[model samples]
Target chain A: MPGRGLNLTDLSYFPGCSLESSARESNISMMEAAEILGLNLIELEDWNCCGSSSANILDKEIAFSLAVRNLSLAPPDRPLMAMCPRCLYHLREAHQRLKEEPETLRAQERRWGRPISLGLSIIHFLEVLVRLGPARLQQGLVRNLNGLKFVPYYGCTLFRPPSLRQGSYYQGEMGNVLTMLGGVPLDKALTQRCCGSFLSAARADVVTPLVNEILASAVAAGAECLVTSCAMCQLNLEIRCTWEPRLPIFHFSEILALALGAQDYEGWFTRHLVDPRPLLQARELIP
Target chain B: MNPPAPALNLRGAASPIVLAEQDRYLARDIERLSRANLSRCFHCRSCGNGCPFIRGMDYPPNGIIRLVQYGLRRQALESHTIWICVGCHTCSVQCPMGIDIAAIMATLRRLALAEGAMIAETNILDFHREVLQSIKQYGRAHKLGIMLRYKARVRQWFADLDVGLRMLAKRKMDLKASRVKAIGEITRLFIPHWKR
Candidate 1:
């Protein structure tokens, strides 16, 4: 909504731990896509962990402090945008807690030696695109998707958390956006299934069947690939699936950048555990 | 109304639980922390039916809520369900009562840790510790470092070795961690007040 009336060209971007390392492709492609759309995403300087699930699980105070530190570092002039849903959730959740607990907010501000803006809006990239309107995306549309059938895998944390219910709901924005770019949105699948989250590391046994079920549902729905906004979901779907003829899991940004004619797709696709190039070539979206 | 389904084979289910043995405060504490009213759960099994990790859990999400409501502190804290839950909120969203079941699971896990209850899933806890440690050291998570430390602690070098190698081949796991500039500020947060 911040970009609706005003033409917001610049925003602060937080690309969490997953995108920063394991999911670099998601980060780079998102940057490329943003550039093509004339949106400048400035990375938050010295940004640390958003007090990931690991931190939140182990210690609440540390998690809250860690997230608050990121909020403290954000520039007050613009709305802060995060590509990772978990990062956005944690950041916003911490911000919400700060709003309710002004005393804790003051303590965190004093500790960080900086003032955090309670008015700073934390938004997801999908909401930004939706707010910018279809005309902006239509302007830079370089390559049609050739009607590539894909599942819009949102994973969890985007809309499921009650704390985030008041925020913009992004349930079908992926389908809406990709549909505009000549892609077929496959709705009859486990689009909102959990991607095994952190359990993928410690208990792959538990995550395997679950990931398999989601992938199986996608395949059953005749989906050729899965497009996910969460980088962790993208990675988990790719690495955890044991079934053959594995569907290539594309980060939402990768597909967007590809359609926008970002030339560095080879760099992104090569990093994928299950190669998406074959699927892309077969669809004739790639050379 | 549908007849109440038979209770699943949960911990301490062999013998009937004496109501007098109940902690009385367990449910109240969990409710306070999670902000989810356990009284609203009608045991429709929606949470259990929708849970992604239900197969791996000893008790379903609703079952855990039932345990807390009964004030079965040890059984609630020691159950495998708490650690198995990744807090995906699948159950929370599916609950007709608008109960944040995932938050309840998280609260149970924290209580279990604080009470030093036997962890049904030590591997998960170890993994979480490694992740937190990586965050503390670099002010951000270094996947390679976390995995290495996790592997060393779990003593399972060969487990998922292929996945690690594949990630390395793709350069997904960075050798060096991306760190915060003002690291002392981060490290200070880790130190307890008494230590400082």
Candidate 2:
């Protein structure tokens, strides 16, 4: 609840790998949204990758060491905010594990050449915004997305494995954000389904059907666009969606940025595989 | 014309079922490594039922757990299930016993790689290796470099080429690699863990 009291102005932000590369739109929009809401995001200096999904599967020790390195680098005074769900999950899980097993932390510290401690609370950006509450979000809203029907896709990492389950796992905060912005929030079952994740890179055949199911469900629910917080989910859904009547995938921050009257919204949409401008313009949510 | 009836065989072919002691050791090792408590699974099949990639798996999540319980190490480790698991954590979330089945899958993958077991899905493992190599080279992921290296290693140069082009056109893919300022520290962290 860092953003709840309005006293939380500055945050230590971990942009992770995807935010710097494929998910640049998410990074841009998130910064724009935060600026409008008067929140300061300080990027962690000399930070490395968070190990993501591949590192854990390949070697747990490496994953732990990597996350511990990142954790050690983060500023301890402010709460650490991770934009990517995978990074947040890995960092939080590693923090918990390292705290529980001091011996492991000691070993990692020996390897990393730095002392580590779980001083800062690692949180997702969505959680920070949610804790800020809808009323605070409403204060900056210039254009209400009245007719835009958005399906809030939580993906898997943000809300799974019991440790990371944020209350209901349906990403109600996304719904709350959309609702506060005067948009229709479709909190359907498919919104929380896995997007086949990294498998999209190796096995698209397996992922295509799953992605199709998610898209089909959103379309079936009469959704105009699919809003997700995860970068991998956005990539998989947009790239694998080859079927007819494709739905534009929007990072939740993009919508939030638009609602806050960001003028260069078209720049963000240009990077998306499926352009969302048509839907937004049709509803006059964007010019 | 009617098809001729097949003749019945007089004797059935028999195969030996040997329970190796090594299987028990392997099961114990997996249990120790994952800390998943294989005995806690009661064939509920909740993990299998909830698994999104069950259809692609040679053995379902419950079946893999059952294999672990019975100490069928060869069968469990060689299964396509471990390779196919995307680590979505659905099985772990839905497990009534609160077992982190995905963690077990990760252990199985490591064991499989260590034992040089025949991987049913080679591309997935290859992709993982390429991604790790990219992380090792650059502190952050370079999308273009990763994809190019992965394609070259997997020898599927043409695969997803169209999507790659589209991403490039859309400015979604970064051509240049970005390295963290403290890459030496990152390399130091990986060297010891990877050496083992």
Candidate 3:
């Protein structure tokens, strides 16, 4: 994690809920990226949910408890990375809430096998890649995404709950990586306006207009496609696109993997609720 | 000049008894959002820009411009929103036009049923009902039981074939947690009209 690029010999990972269910592309794309880069990501033998926005839907206690459970499953030394922002938010928020406040810390200290009073270095996958630098990504690229306008959509979870570190990091780092990958990273100032995350369930009617505003702006700005780091965003976007808009939505990792030739044109990419094949097909990038 | 509100009854099943304004737009009752929300739109076209799922729509969300302002209600209903909308409000929050597209959608959904608008994938509603039932039975979702039951209901048996095996292998889903809970208390949560 610290020495330039990921030393495959010392890398590890924890795939979160969004990838486990609805948005499965992130899982494959990241694996494909690691494989292409010769970085062997050792996935934990047994993993748990990061207790997304759902856990925090009402109270922080339930959210924190669920986050603690997932983190406890990780080994102490290796840094853990996740794709979904809600996962990122929960894990980071739980860690910060526990470490900063003693009552929370002491309570959590008793829960883990060895008192993990000092939090695990929970990181988002975006952090690992950006830190590796654009040069690292450039060396890994199989195709050039130059003229193909791209919109980087960081859903509510990735850049939200400003108090949380992991969520903040992905929001900050992915921009640099997008620049590094040689595509137009949408510079729209409100790029992180809550895509209403889990709010879609209780407020779909209110949310439809909200979703339209985002897609309209991205297209107006000349984005031919949008990139996301959260699985929920992928699921919500795919399910709600009832009206026509031709832009393809890609999990950030999948697009990066595709650019790096680590992964391209397969699996959930084919099963998307809305066909993103045109983007790939238009680019002659599809298999 | 503003056009007068359409004279369509938008009221109760063309009846022996006339209904009031509140009873109008009968379909809005089901989705719980209003059609007037759609009128505020001037088509600045913000929501369509940030949408991650824009590629799939036959109408593209920007058509909200064409839907409400132009009174393309029936045309909008027949679009995929009725079948695919999971009710995520990102569009509502992102709208610079201030149009409540989601509410417009809710109204459209209600109208679809009232007019018997070509009910596309009946599963969209069915999925919600099943999820509701699962949450009512357990305070939380019992993944296996719900998926199995939902799959049985929808006949999309092959969808996500990897889930059952994966959950079974992970041991996260247990059949025991799926007992139907205090039905009376949960059923009461369904009192008519206090809905979204």
Best by DockQ: 1
Write the residue-wise lDDT of candidate 2 on A78-137 in tens digits.
788998989988888888888789888788777666677556678888877877777779
lDDT of 1 by residue, A180-217 (tens): 99999999999898999999999999999999999999
Please identify model 1 stretches exceeding 4 Å from their true place.
A1-7, B1-12
Which pairs, if any, clash in model 1?
A: none
Mark the 10 consecutive residues where model 3 chain B has the least summed lDDT.
B10-19
**Local error of candidate 3 at B127, Å?**
12
Score every model by TM-score.
0.97, 0.92, 0.59
lDDT of 3 by residue, A1-287 (tens): 23233332345576764465445567888788877766667775445545443333322354466567556666666666666666666677677766778887776656444355253666677777766667777887777765567777876555434345233344556656766666667666346655645434433554566667777778788777777777667655654444586467788887778778754556746656556777777877665
TM-score per model (chain B)? 0.92, 0.83, 0.65
> What DockQ values do the models have?
0.83, 0.64, 0.04
Which 10-residue window in model 2 chain B sums to the lowest lDDT?
A: B7-16
Task: Order the candidate numbers by DockQ, best to worst.
Answer: 1, 2, 3
Give the number of the best model, judged by TM-score: 1
Residue B118 alpha-carbon offset, candidate 2, angstroms = 2.3
Structure candidate 2, residue pairs in collision:
none
Q: What TM-score should be assigned to candidate 2? A: 0.92
Per-residue CA lDDT of candidate 2, range B1-196, in tens? Answer: 7654321111121212245533667667878988878778887889988888876777788877766776777777878889999888899989999889998998988988888888878888888887787778887778788888889888998989899999999988888887887777766656664574
